[model samples]
Target: MLIKPVQDMLLHNADHYLIPADIVAVVQADNNLYHAFLVLTKIKYSKIPVLDNDGHFEGLISLPLITEQMLGFDHLNTEILMHMHVSDVMETHVKTVQAVSDVEATLHLMINDPFVPVVDADGIFQGIITRREFMKSFNFLTHEIGKQYDMIEKDFSSSEKTN
Candidate 1:
């Protein structure tokens, strides 16, 4: 079946699906690696958004990025590394989607990232939509469609019997 209608229906209430920024764990660009590491450990999140001091969205940081940098050092300099800023290792090229974006656009952005950061028209950080959430919504829509198909089949069968 065509998914445009489903996409429209889902995107109509897209704001409701967003995980607001307030609830998300975000590290500041100037934050030390030690702090970033601690937050990542505490949250147990693979990746977390980075923000600047002005509360503008910066990029994303992941545990692997930290580990990759750490691996380059023959001698683990915990003290020096601890002072490294998040911006030094954070990925600047990030995929972002607007809060009002359609599901198809959001899904396309999410293909390369675990979660797509949601922003406002003014480029203000709003929240994120994770792959998990998207999958859950898609599954629900498919399940509901299946039920509707079953009902239609039953109705058709009943009409045939009557005729």
Candidate 2:
């Protein structure tokens, strides 16, 4: 459940390097959602990042958002794209998980969060935790340490049952 071990796992993965940093970039407030979409189109297979003016974690400008907007665009004039700012559409009340947070907490955060923004203690943006990363981490955790998941899951279920 430690972050150091999880970070090490991330680093140890052979395909981790293939995962580009820009795959989880934070977008600035000045950036338009349209521009964001354009950037996404350029890196369609990668994760999207959204950041604040000070390079803090804002929220994710995800593929789902783009797909939703694109699908709904038929109802609006095409020019509506040009006037759309990220602030106008981005989730302002973003849920952030600290970089030092334990892996278990991060998993819970990711489970409930629309998109979990990973940040440092100062709230500066680090990277993001996608469902993919969660899955990958889970694979690593369970595979490397058998029965760890069973114990963790049992504890979690007990807590829920008690609550």
Candidate 3:
């Protein structure tokens, strides 16, 4: 089997890198900020996807987004967090990539963005590709390439000695 270098491997599609939607933490658009806050607090992730009742991608919600709504003149207004919908404060202008998006394009985006949401043709959420996961995969592949090079070098040296 042949393995391509990182430069060549990046040309592949992004589907293999996805962390599927079924395992990703998500919030409903209709949920209140308080509810969103609870989930965000529980999960170690910085942000989560917001879905509509029908499982369509809506936006992204984070602690800051939810907390901003709770701010008041003198105190944190519990009312806003408990009453306002998540759709009100969640980030709608999120950067997203399709399952078949180019890995190189996705890599460029991940440089600044922490995670890129994955959506289908109809805007249905599929999964997310996080920077951490990408980095880990990159590291593993590079190491594998190094191993392959070492093996090739050993083979070349042994063959030269036999001549």
Give residue 1's lDDT in candidate 2 (0 to 100). Answer: 50
What TM-score does each of the candidates earn? 0.80, 0.61, 0.78
Evaluation by TM-score, superior candidate among 1 and 3 = 1
lDDT of 2 by residue, 18-64 (tens): 22335554567678667777777777543456777777766666655
Model 2, clash count?
A: 4
What does candidate 1 score on TM? 0.80
Query: Relative to the unseen true structure, what is the C-alpha lDDT of residue 65 in candidate 1, on a scale of 0 to 100?
Result: 80
Top-down lDDT ranking: 3, 1, 2
* Model 1 Cα lDDT, one tens digit per residue, 1-163: 3366577555645656789999999999999888888899899998999999777899998988877666644675557558689999999888787764557778787777778898777767888898877877777776665553433335555557755
lDDT of 2: 0.59
- Between which residue pairs do clashes occur in model 2? 25-49, 27-49, 27-50, 27-51
Give the distance in Å from residue 5's predicted Cα in candidate 3 to where it truly belongs: 3.9
Q: What stretches of model 2 exceed 4 Å from their correct place?
A: 1-23, 45-47, 63-76, 112-115, 146-163
Error of 1 at 6 (Å): 2.1
lDDT score, candidate 3: 0.79
| Residue 32 shift from truth in candidate 1, angstroms | 0.8
Candidates 2 and 3, the one with greater lDDT? 3
